[model samples]
Target: MAPKHDLQYPKGAQNTLNRYSDRGSYDLEKVHKIVNSTPVLHVSFQPDPSDPFPAILPMIGQMGSFERPSSSISDPLDCYLHGYISSRVMNVSRAAIASGKPGLPVCIAASKVDGLVLSLTPNSHSYNYRSAVLFGYATPVTDTEEKEWAMEMITNSVVPQRYDNTRIPPIPAEMQSTQILRVTIDSASSKVRDWIPSDSAEDMANKEVVDKVWVGVVPVYETYGEPIPSPLNKVEKVPEYIEEFLKESNEEGLAYATAAGKRPLPVKAKTNHDE
Candidate 1:
């Protein structure tokens, strides 16, 4: 096994961070962390060669290793995406594999805003966020065991232990209707800005601009509110698992965002390519 810091996706044109490169990282852990944490990942692929536009779909995705179920987040892992069998992306991936192509070439992106950076100038205004982009080839999971495992993995990602809590095993119809796409990532990178506002030196020199403009960070985070029971909910009260997940997630999100708002900017611009 390689050392933890030695494990990283190779930097290339596809995954390089050009602008404000100081905030970028090619660390597999950081890239995967942003992807797994985000609620939705935007997957992009060209559906038709002749078409002018590429199709982008919002999907539920999780990073995990079926072969090594106990693997840590820092380890290399494939991205499992959950969708309906009839979805266009699933059909395209299936066709690509059938045609002898490696898989459907794709780009997946996930981003979460930690704070709003209010600067003295509009050009300097920016968002404190964690964003990751992954380039990969996606193929439909054909093996029954792997598909079912991926299903359970993805379900639990939404809410911890949700798969076992709700239903034992999916009915045949339910299994038939769902599809899982395993993306073999070729390269990936993440850009994260979790710091206080940065203003131009000229603007800082002018105390008038600083005095007039409100320069600060407005911390942002996803909040999970009190769970509302479904109309047909038979359980008298919410399960302890659900309550615990909500409490833990909400607290973690708020704390991270708050800390990001107060952090100092990155001291230097660095990228994997620089090495």
Candidate 2:
């Protein structure tokens, strides 16, 4: 039997990493995981051809296949973005579809800093981070079934099983007001830095400089605070799902960041700033 190999997004000029190329990956699994785990994504798109400035909006999005619902993260998936119906991005996407274009061109980015790398010099300082970028065409989801499914998936991405816990289905008014964009990705890539601080050999050999300068990684992770209830809430205690979600999410984040903080220095890591 042939060995199974991980699927990768083809590297192209649109989604290629130039500097620090060693840390970059085209693996679909790595890229999708970073995007799905990120709470907010920055989506950039041009409103019009004559517009001077491109618009970048922080949006909530999730990656999944509507046709193959059970597909894994490594499998190809479209990014589903939630936004207001009348938003500029949505309007542009709608217009593009109406004009018979494939969809509106967009770039989606997600990033998370796990640790702050304090090196010998300010120039050498960096962050232990994971970042992904995707170039895609954003088309408005017009089908009722697909839109609702995307909504449910996005809601669950925030808190596991959250969609079912709340309303079974969105009300007519809510459905009418919300808009979902299905992004067909052309290419994707991710870059990760998860090693201990790197410093030049000259700096490391200098006792005075090494003694004076503190060089290490400070782990950073997001923490979820206790849930505050609404004024009209009847329930005295928080739901178990909410409590468990917070605990598990916090633990997972801390573990990842802390592990990165303690990671051994890479053998081939660039010691000089220019390198």
Candidate 3:
């Protein structure tokens, strides 16, 4: 894989790192890849006046540079999120823009755990992880061309080559029922923690303590299970594309997790989100 070129997001009040700031990264490639890799994003937005508290939702979203369709996930791009046409979030974005207010402001967060860190001392335990947060202004997609492109981009993200494997284009009913939001990111930051456990010098020097406890990272990752076809289907065999994709994906996940378990941090630019 080609190395992702890093582009740093300008530091701002909203995105400045405070704790363990050395781990914080403003690199656009790292931030965007984390956001895209997370299976579910936690999106927080201001609630309606009727509610006293802010609201957040678990949503699936994809990053797409429609103008630069071939752009990698690490590239700076607009986040296209899918939701019901009448969903409160979508309605809020529209209402905000229509009222001459700046588009609805939101915070997007994603995270991944790579390993379980074990230490002789309980207080020193932690997990190896990568997490990111992005602040953005969102607007309801208005152009027909842009909307269609976003829809296809999101569909394929659910599974590799899924959009082309199952359907050619969506029907009118499907398109009308779904809504897309284009989020233009303003600032973002990511923090990564991947390293050997840091136990106290006393704990490290004690042979009794070291002998009694197990210490090492347990690699954690997602893997694809065997595919089960629909009962009504007449096909006797699975599609080659589907089989190949599943195999390759599993291999990639295993290889990465193994490497993570052996090293404190990866040296190459990551394209896949590993949580």
Candidate 4:
């Protein structure tokens, strides 16, 4: 097996994981943490069993959702559904690995922002974010107990205590309605980007041109709204568990909840005070 550290990529593919391998390698610890921290995985492989596989899966699904997005959406429902499907796919991929049919590795990415840095040169433009990526085969949970635990891990992975608050997963007979797969990790890497712009010689020469326009980066962030109770449930008072979900600050959690058919919290109306 090619150690994740030894895996190679075509030129132009940034090797961000090289320096962060010790912390980034998708080992058991990282895998568990990742599965718990976020419920998403970007999976791709040569679908053909023969060589010269000339096809790639469509990036967007029929519903206008993608395995990966260049930018995050503000809608919590959209975000949650995206993560739910992504996590399910990842689980299936892992199950394939556990079945002894080791498939291609998938990429998992999580990014956080510190601040944006503006620069005088277009080439120097960038932002600060803490990100980690894992390239590994997901191991399957075959044991019934382990499988259930994996499911719970995935559930709580999205929203802490979510499974405990909601109904526990059904037995295999009932779960059969849903598809589940597991994968074992083989190798992986991690990386980060946090550099500020340093003006190059040409940029310095064109200082006037650079200064003529605004040259600062606008920071990006993910936020959540209040929970909208289900129409079926007419309880005027919201449950603490559901209310706590609203107080949580995970974009992935918000996305997962929305995808699971939960409604987003309503926006609070503001009052005009002493005019």
Instruction: Estimate every model's Cα lDDT from 0 to 1.
Output: 0.89, 0.93, 0.82, 0.42
Best-fitting candidate, measured by lDDT?
2
Better structure of 1 and 2 per TM-score: 2
Q: Quick one: ranking by lDDT, best first?
A: 2, 1, 3, 4
Off by more than 4 A, model 3: 1-5, 265-275
TM-score of each: 0.95, 0.97, 0.89, 0.56
Lowest summed lDDT window (length 10), candidate 3: 266-275
Expressed as tens digits, the lDDT of each residue in 1-275 for candidate 1 is 96645479998989988887777889989998999999999999999889899999999999999999998888999999999999999999999999999999999999999888887888777788999999999999888899999999898989999999877689889989999999999999999888777766677789888889998889999999999998998999889999999999999999998999898765562111111
lDDT of 3 by residue, 1-275 (tens): 99956678899999999876777899888888888778898889986878888889898898788789998766778888889999989999999999998789999999988878776777767777889999999898878788889988787776777788776678889889989999988899999877655566677679999999998788777789999989898879988878988898789877766677777533331221122
Error of 2 at 31 (Å): 0.4
The RMSD of every model to the true structure, in order and in angstroms, is: 3.3, 1.3, 4.7, 14.3
Q: Which model, 1 or 3, shows the larger TM-score?
A: 1
Which of 2 and 4 is ahead in TM-score?
Answer: 2
Worst 10 residues of 1 by lDDT: 266-275
Query: Which candidate comes out best when scored by TM-score?
Result: 2
